[model samples]
Target: MQALPKTRTDGRLPLYARLRDQLASRIANGEWSPGDMIPSENRLAEEYGVALATMRMALKQLVDEGLLERRRGTGTFVKQPAFRADLFRFFHVHDVEDPDGPVIPESRILSRQEVDLPPEVKRAFGDDAGGRCLKLERVRLWAGDPLLFEEIYLRLPDFDGLMSLDPKEMGPLLYPVFLQKFGILISSATDELSFGTATQASAKYLELPANSPVAVIERIARNPVGRIIEYRRVHGRPERFRYRVNLGEQHT
Candidate 1:
């Protein structure tokens, strides 16, 4: 039997809510990884010293929030993000020969260092976040041409030892590294797409003339419990940008 922390010390919070917070913290801390089956509800109920129904309610909340998924004959496992599909949906990279086939661009990490957080980035990570964070500068290339210049920001401590890793080992996608190395599962992201003129730095890396119009994508990525983990701003050549969407039943 385990005791739930009374950090809130509020009598109004339900027992199941406290249990939910504890379980979420365990998941965040990597007690169970993505695709790994969690202990059964009966077992958890015993371990937590809570009623079966109470445990079920707590688990149900996580399931509803997409942190966990249930299998009928099997048990519950942590939900894995569909990164490939999600990436293609946002990046719009594809093979030249097979335009419909999604492809991952070759990535070159320019720099990695600890830096003071930008105002917007700090706000997204919330008030408790440290003033400093890990910042990365990278460029994506395809067909030997620079396609996108990226400025990526990650929360501190959560990604503490990442600076020691060789950039070449990280490859193109960062979400996989987040989960496999740090046990941080990126569940979802919200990207805002807009058209903007390139900055001097963006122009230098993107091989564009000064003030060239570019496709801008600002993304806020979150974990299963909705903690913002990464904030990225990408600028791509407008000519290479493509957006496809299908609406109505016909597309379905």
Candidate 2:
């Protein structure tokens, strides 16, 4: 029988709840990515030395939580978030003449490496996250003019080997590369916007004077199972930043 790690799961919880936590942990650890079919109930029950009903109960819990979905006849697969494609829409550049037309800016990766996470960022990743993570510095440009400077951090092991990839091949969009290369699907993100003075590094990248006012955006991105995968901080030229939203009930 495959034993659940005693240290990670609470022993006082019911077996099915423990199983649910174990399965959720596996998904959070990137064991089974979006669209990957998991083992069948009978098979999982056999492997865990549990009854078929117990395994079914655990799986049902996951399905109800939107972490997994059962196919009609095939098997259970990880639930893929439908909003992933539009996650980066806020960062897209637009042409002045065609305001409705969104243009993908050219991306230039300045650096990518493993580094110790800042205290605040490490806290954001939770207590279990290790001290180190992958850090990426990049800039986005439109018509040869810099539009944004970004400092991105990703959880380690989950994003291992990302530093080895060639930046030129990644293009402007990174979520697709993340899914295609790392099997990580960003399901949702929360962006916090504010105004801040540009630091020397950001000023250099954005072609602005040090201490110039800039628009700041801090984003925390999560996977389908709701595990935090990436934390990003972006500095954009204030003049180029725009936020639009429509409120009220929708009618078809």
Candidate 3:
């Protein structure tokens, strides 16, 4: 049994709440990863010297907040939200020959550098913002046809080695790279999509006419601990844009 840290001395917080906070800190700190089953409630109760009911209550709070999942027979595991999952829900590269076939676009990094962040990016990073960040301009292609132009930004020092990575050795995705190479887990993101005219840069990469209407997406990604990790903007022809979201049961 791991010795639990006593919650703040103030005692204003309830025992269960303090226990919940400590366990959540472990998850956020990556001490317990996304799919690991946490210690059993009885074990946790014994370790923390709390009542079984108190331990259950702490676990319940985390489950309700979407940070933990209680499996009927498999015990509880940490919950990880992959905001990138929405990328598939919102768009797909269709094969013209077989329109319903699954296609994964290939990414090609065109340029990389360290640069001062734009005001919006600085605002997104807030206090974690640095003087400069690693920026990459890339394109995605499907069936050898260019489909999207992307600009990705990463905070400095935390991602210092990223600028030197060879594009030839990179994969089609970025989040996995952040996880494997940098120990950064992109747990969630906020994305906005709208119509916009293609800039010269986007037009050049996506091979679209300048000023043509395009689908634009602005995404802000965060790690498990809620630190901003990436700010990305992408442009694609409007015809290929799609979006969806699921909600709880509708009220009568």
The prediction achieving the highest TM-score against the true structure is 1
lDDT of 2 by residue, 75-182 (tens): 999887553323235554666899775566778999999999988689779876898999999998888998889999999988888888877768788987887787
In model 2, state the lDDT of residue 1.
86
Which stretches in model 3 have alpha-carbon errors above 4 Å? 1-22, 45-67, 79-85, 95-103, 243-252
Q: Candidates ranked by lDDT, best first?
A: 1, 2, 3
The runs of at least 3 residues in candidate 1 whose Cα sits more than 4 Å from the true structure, single-residue gaps closed, are: 4-19, 49-54, 85-92, 96-102, 249-252
Question: Could you estimate the TM-score for every candidate?
Answer: 0.83, 0.69, 0.78
Best by lDDT: 1
lDDT of each: 0.84, 0.82, 0.80
lDDT of 3 at 161: 84
Stronger candidate by lDDT (1 vs 2): 1
- Judged by lDDT against the true structure, how good is candidate 1? 0.84
**Candidate 3 least-lDDT 10 residues:** 81-90
Question: Every model's Cα RMSD, please?
Answer: 3.5, 4.8, 4.2
Off by over 4 Å in 2: 1-32, 36-92, 95-103, 249-252
What's the alpha carbon RMSD for model 1?
A: 3.5
Evaluated at residue 223, the lDDT of candidate 2 is: 68
> Which one wins by TM-score: 2 or 3?
3
